[model samples]
Target: MEEALPIRKIIHVDMDAFYASVEQLDNPELRGKAIAVGGSSKRGVVAAASYEARKFGVRSAMSSVLAKKMCPHLIFVKSNFDRYRELSQRIRNIFFEYTDLVEPLSLDEAYLDVTENKKGNPSATLIAQEIRQKIKEKTSLNASAGISTNKFIAKVASDINKPNGQKTVPPEAVLGFLENLEIKKFYGVGKVTKEKMYRHGIFTGKDLKAKPLEYLQEHFGKSGSYYYHVVRGIHNSAVKPTRTRKSLAAERTFSENISSEVYMLERLETIAEEVERRLTKNNVAGKTITLKIKYSDFTLQTRSKTLPFYISSKSLMLDAVKDLLFQEKMKNSVRLLGISLSNLNNEKKEQQPEPEESIDVQLKFDF
Candidate 1:
């Protein structure tokens, strides 16, 4: 007889409108009001939107101008990242109380593996509820969660209920849950992939499962395999406690397009300084420096150079950026400028993988 595979319990916790919620939490008057956390200037983008603002079609990454137009009464508040980070740390501390196997996706969201946890809890559903409640008690913020056997399903389930609620896809329900899920709601399917899936008559998990692996690979390339297994509830990704930072960058979008090389260099100097400060804070340096340019027509161009040694100083970074800047003439007036550093000295070395355990067991557990 074959040994039964261990069914790990995973939970994905996502704070509700984190940045905007922080703004609202700090200012009682801002509560229950439509607000956006970002500049309301012409070039400003919405960093986050309150649930009230979301009802008006204001969303993060939307232009502030459009956000205001969408909700004329929308109030714009400047972002307070320091406060956000402090509260995020508080929330993360709560997760550590239950399990050290926590993987933070961002300041507002994380994946927690609690199959065998400090609390000795076997019910991931109850664990998720406790975490959410503790986050509220500690930070006065609302959080939603998804509980499931894998990270992908847990992540998708987390969004089923918004603003302080959770959903658990138990082992027995995983297949049916995924089959009925909208193709767009699959964790990895973005607008482009959704359209491609639509073109291929893949409208939902069931539709995707209907195609053979070879057919999927022929059309979707490497990702076809990913779609194939995830829909069948075969995702086995572990919840890693620590994730390495791949790159560091800083950028600014101008209020007006500037074509002069001197002006561009002036802006690049400031951007490089910001990047250097971030690198110093992270205590890492990089060999590759890239200069990103966005033209008035919204076209982007990037130039990079790699050095023999890692350098994090603004002076060194600016020197490389200047070469890349002058290497090519301005295709058009520039609207945005950015500096990024890759090939960092702190990159993690690859480790050999262990074979994955099967997820083929019938899960009768409760969330």
Candidate 2:
């Protein structure tokens, strides 16, 4: 038999509690303090909570009222999407410098394929270290990175050490790691799934892997095949880049609702800057600009402009954004403001050229 194929190296990079951490980093007073990003009212949910607040049992998706009850001195601030997006762009630029095969899970997380990287480095562990260092140096932020032979293992490795941590799962160690891992800790195995697994005495990765394929299929349905492969440390997913812009948007909701158009414009300026950076990064022009407004009561409205020609420059894009903003009729005082650009060009071919296709005739067999 022929030799087996070499393993592909993958890395998963995730920022630590991105929004809350950024807020704490910007305002030194908030450091080591319990802080949550959301409303203090009954209707609000916690978008993010600082590490300090987490110590009080506060978490994302929990009610702000409950969070406040847990930590009486909790600081509640509204979401600042503009600032978050700006920081996310800077992080993306850093990822591009290392390898272009980056698949962004969201603004705060991404998977990078570095089997044949530009750094000429043989160790994936070193690449993870370098990327983490660059993110901290450039953004003053902490990121957790996981390096492994594939996405499944790589993603799990990243979370092993969080908050400015990096870890690697070498191919030789994968079996031992998987065998000892708690079943509940496996990706996609949520509380409900874990409960069912517990009822069936499947408490570890080894337990799941030892089960008959048919038994797993009978219980977990189609995902049984997926679990089987993952437990065996075999994943086939490739790092795909299919980011097409159906729309580009920048939005911000304030801590306190205000009716002042002057204050709204100031906020809009920051939002416009973020949109410009994204447009420039994609090298695409937009023909339509939309302005979104959310009133104090949470009612929303929008005014849009479809330009004669596509434009992406900072000044031109901001002008269209301003025009859209000015055209909207104010009702009950705006609490949130946003700007978006759409109708982008998808034909830019400056980055990579088309590869020639070939058809081979011979298939050699060693019998």
Candidate 3:
């Protein structure tokens, strides 16, 4: 039998109703009310709903018109992204106090690996508690944390306690914990995937572990390997820092609308070259390319393609941009053109056989 690796202490921290919480913290009167931060018009959607609003079935992304119908007294507040972003930075500083292995997941959630922490604290649970305390003290907001031997369990644990609490799963209890977990509760297992699992007779972790790897791979494609290992309680993923952006793009605003297809393609080529030069200066290859164009009518559209691999070559990017420009119709006079590339790589993950899904846990936070 293979020896078990030493236990790795992982913590997953997620702010409670992040945007809504920030609003509540900033305006004390908003606390304990059914407040939503988003558009108030029928066409607008709710960006975040306070816990009080949730009681009326109002939720994030729900149309504001419907949200108001759900709760006639629902309060609509405008989004203040600038303030929220500033607060997110303050919370990030709290994570740095323990370990440098902090991975941000948007402006709200993050995964922190404290297996070998700078705080010299051996217990991941204690670290999570301390972090929560610090965040409350610093931001005047509550956050829930989960601590466990691996990222999968830690993430689930954090959700279990919720809103303003912490939970931990010991290494030995992993199997039991998973066996009791619902299929929908599994990270990355969405409604569509859950329905598929039900058809496959996979209702829980134990049910999942019973399947052969080959069977899962045949069905789930790229995500199959993940289900195989996570059901068995194995995860080897590490946190990845948010690195600096490597490319900048500039676009020309045409004075008059030009409807010529060939002209648009040529313009795209020039923009792609500018983006390519910037990538070269920074020594980066972006697998994804985004094409931006604005029409004379002020309507805009952006189309993108991600190569199987990243490249910094100007010719290659220009060629790809040309293909995209030709694929779509030139509905109006081209008023502007732009191009950008992201998904940079110093080392490519796709080059290797995918490390198990659970093993790519930290990378999941980037989503």
Candidate 1 lowest-lDDT run of ten: 351-360
TM-score ranking from best to worst?
Answer: 1, 3, 2
Q: Each prediction's Cα RMSD?
A: 3.1, 10.4, 7.0
lDDT of 2 by residue, 178-235 (tens): 8899998888888888999998889999999899878988999977767877787767
- Residue by residue across 199-238, what tens digits does model 3's lDDT show? 9999988888888989999999978888887776776676
Tell me the spans in candidate 3 whose CA falls farther than 4 Å from its real position: 1-4, 242-285, 288-343, 350-367
Model 2 earns a TM-score of 0.67
TM-score of each candidate structure, all chains considered together: 0.86, 0.67, 0.73
> What does candidate 1's lDDT look like per residue over 93-132, in tens digits?
9999999999999999999999999988778999999999
Model 1 misses residue 354 by how many Å?
Answer: 10
Q: What is the lDDT of residue 193 in candidate 2?
A: 89
lDDT value, candidate 2, whole model: 0.81
Judging by TM-score, tell me the better candidate of 1 and 3: 1
* Model 1 spans with C-alpha error above 4 angstroms: 1-4, 285-290, 299-331, 343-345, 348-358, 362-366
* Ten-residue region with minimum lDDT total, candidate 2: 358-367
Q: Which structure is stronger by lDDT: 1 or 3?
A: 1
